[model samples]
Target: MTATGERNALDPEPIQSRLRALLDHHPDGPLPDAALRQIRTSIAPDHRSRPPSTGTLKERAQRHEAESAAARAELIESIHAVDPTPEGLLEFGRHVRRNVEPSGFASNMGAAEFAMAPGAIRAAAEHLLDTGTSLAEICIGLNLLSLAPRDGDSERIRIFIPLGRRIEGTAIKALGRIGRAGPHLAWAAERTPVYRRLGAVQAIWDLPEREFSELLYALPVKQSADLVQMFSALDSRPEGLQGDRRFARILRDAARPGALEAEPEALALAAQLWDEVRYGRCALLGFAPGEREMTTAGFQALLASPEASASVDAALAATPEDPDLVWLRMRLNRAAHSDPPLPRGLAVRVSVPRPSIATQARTHLLLDGVPLVEAHFQRGHSGRPETVLHDGRGLEALAEPRDVKIGDTGCVEECCGAFRAVISRRGGLVEWEVRDTVLKDPPTTRLTFDADQYDAEVVRAAADFDWEWPARRAARLLRERIGAESELMSRWECELAWTGSWSPDRSEMQYSFYYPKRPSGNDAYVQFSAARDVPYVPEVDDGAVMAVVDRIIADLRTTDPKSTARLSGGSREYAEALGFPWPP
Candidate 1:
């Protein structure tokens, strides 16, 4: 049969198996030309024209909701009518198997449970858990038990935790909803196959703080990306590692001697913790008192050891731009620096303005108190004087002695063709070499700085957050408080877009919310304006901003819900990437 015909006639598994065999037979070299042509034809995209979609996204969504509601109603009626007889329940399970799509079946069961009495639902669910023969019946039982969780429901759910992916996934969800499932979830998180442990970790993520912290401390460090995500989630939480000496000890142990070489993820986690401390996102000794001193000493010790330094160098070579590795390199540089003579007259300074509700914190670089770009370039620049060096890390990059491009002319470099500067250090002097300017007579072709003075000023500027804007500070607080991976964010239909307007009086900060999952035309937004102002006052603004965020989250719980759960997870990265009206 032709490849297309075979694909149409047989199951995908057999076709995949055949393809795998074909590739394996020729593992030594490239496949024969005829075979390659055949493979290409088999997997080629179908270019056949088809009718365009008929309805708008809103219309389609409304239709789907109506259908789902009707189907759920029918499921409720069928399950409600089932005689308490075993045979009747078995037949009802068969009915569900025939009608409901597997993808939606579990949720349907849970939704239907809401329409019936808790006792009735629990009794039916328990029956299925205890004696149901089919997978469908048992899954339905698990879903129902999730909503009407009893003291022993978790035990019943635990039975199916190791069955397989589909069953275990449903089982995990059910256990997560049960308050008593902590022990079981922890057990599963540790004992389950590495690939399957993410579900277990997520299930236990919302456990009581004490239990969660204890479990986090006890959990063995693994090299799974899921564990990295778990670490990220932990770092984002305000209470994470705070006043937890035991957990801090666990982290310190992970960073000991060769631990980072064995598991690179430990390094990432360490860097995240260090970043939190450096940025003042968390308490200095919240994890363990004197952690900063311990960490610095450890890093210095690593630098002293040739073998450890080699391993770090190798990792840095592999991922040079990795923020964790970059931070490590910076630390190493700091440790190695000797007291050099202070440069005369030249200084590096930055002006970071308070972000208004409608604007972002614009950072401008200055040399000896003179604006670098604004003072030199007139045309092709935004009068706003916003430079690219917004984050402290950007300033760190600027401090490096290598030739670095700071920012281009405000317009597109390829089109308008304006001059760019290559900032580099030669001997004790730092020089900015200007190139590609349209003006024959530019203001100045070069600007110079003293290398020692430049490095000190940049480092000082990067560490100082005194000039930070209130809106940006509020965003950081929200990230720490709500957590980037919090289940609460998953409930929102719209992602929190970072672009917002500050009221003219700077009294309120408004944020734009976008529905990324929806179609282009249907991706509507709602404005979330908080009562706050520029120049953050910790005492007055923090509580007020949190209250506003709380209100927004509460509103999303009802208005947005699960139907619009997108992958953005309300992360700042996702929001910025969506191309909303971001402030400069």
Candidate 2:
């Protein structure tokens, strides 16, 4: 104040007096006096500690990376203490999985930590393989290698551990033992762990000739589908799983009289399925082939397959009427334009109510969402419900409907005038006409039906004739071979008759067997019936049909010695004409 004449800014007495006056002016202010008194103490340099301003984003990221790197360094150092033995490797895998970042890419902490130290990883894997370590341990080692960042040939590592990890010496020896242990794979499947068992099964195609033959014989028919899947997974090139030599061997073994006699339908289906898969076709048969047809070279290769003859023989003996099998037979014979043009997206529906003592009933037939025909019938008290038709309203609507009978029961109902149906295509428009006045009722009943209807009828008849045999066989197979849970069941009634039939207007098969508890003579014999209004497929030789009859008769004989075998009443005369021994 004396030197510059400025107000005495450092004067404490004046400063205190000014503050007191200001505070007194605002005594009822927001803050209480006690709060004001403690403000200086609360905000003193010693007490004030708000965080300082953060650095730039790049700077902050750099700091985080450094810290993470240090932490990872510490983790790796700790993991290194674990020995590179099988047990140690498992522990390391656990550690890596636990620490792996969500993004899978972290400079400081990531699966790359394992890749950086391949020495330990490889050593542990080799040690596990050398030692007869458990499959789980080997899997853990392989998983670690798979997950590690790929610095080099990651595929090589995978090859070393194969999906089943069966490359180990012990595993290989065990697999060899399985091949020598006869055809039944159940034992091997049970003895080994899941992965090792699967590995052994996959090696079936590569087994020696004798071993392969044994395996096929021992392979359960129920497991045939599974075997096909495994075989399909193998190499499918011409020289691959379907090569001439191997396919021939498989066909010969499967077609052997013994194999066929044991599981006729299953073995045939398996062989056919194998061929289909080898040819790059779906395993399921009956459907039309896709757009891509095989080239001449591929066709020639199929022709040259050693098993071609055997497969044909089996088809004839097993399922001759199967459209797919019949077509396969013709194709193998180098027949021209043998493939049938099966309609796509065709669905068949049949509504048959549970039969009672009623005298009259009706059955409706639908094909691909369109009503084709209805069969109204009045069965004599003792006879089967006879199907009859009157006006051809539904038939005329079809592309080409033939054979219009008001009440035709396939058999000679009354030669007054049998019916005939004509189906044809004109300018891509299908026409079906049923003629009720066709004079020519052939001396023998020659029915014409579509391929689907024919195939469905055959299947239905086979299922119905001696039905108990299949049911028993399936139950036994499930119990003895597969060890499936199957308890004994009881029958409450005597089976009498079954309805196995089909209609030309629909591609559906109908089957139902009658069972009655009463000892009435009405339920005396097993009556099976089937109707056909379509022509039998030309691709299938008559021999196949004979084989099916023989099998049915054999089953009937086994099931009931005194009973007469009548498969599809319409076919009885045909069976007799062919010397099929069906009535026996």
Which lDDT tens digits does candidate 2 get at residues 230-330? 44323221124323333333433443333332222343344333334322212122222431123222333433354555766676677665433443443
TM-score of 1: 0.37
**Model 2 misplacement above 4 A:** 1-79, 84-116, 146-297, 304-584
Q: How many pairs of residues collide in model 2?
A: 20
lDDT value, residue 386 of candidate 1: 21
RMSD of each: 21.9, 32.5
Considering every candidate listed, which one attains the maximal lDDT?
A: 1
Residue 134 displacement in candidate 2 (angstroms): 1.7
Query: Candidate 2: what lDDT?
Result: 0.35
Residue-by-residue lDDT tens digits, candidate 1, 1-584? 54421223332322224334655575422233344345334433333753454699999889777877787677667768766555665556556545543345563355435567777777677665554434455567788878887677676676455443566688877876666566777655434433335566666666777876666655564223223234323212323423545444554555466655422334434443332323222222334455744654453454445553465578877875443344344344433543222234433332221111112233345444333443344433211212334322343324454433343444565665454566666777777775545656655477777767777776664555543334544554554444454555445544444433232223344444445442355343333333334333322355666676666566555665333333333344444655444333
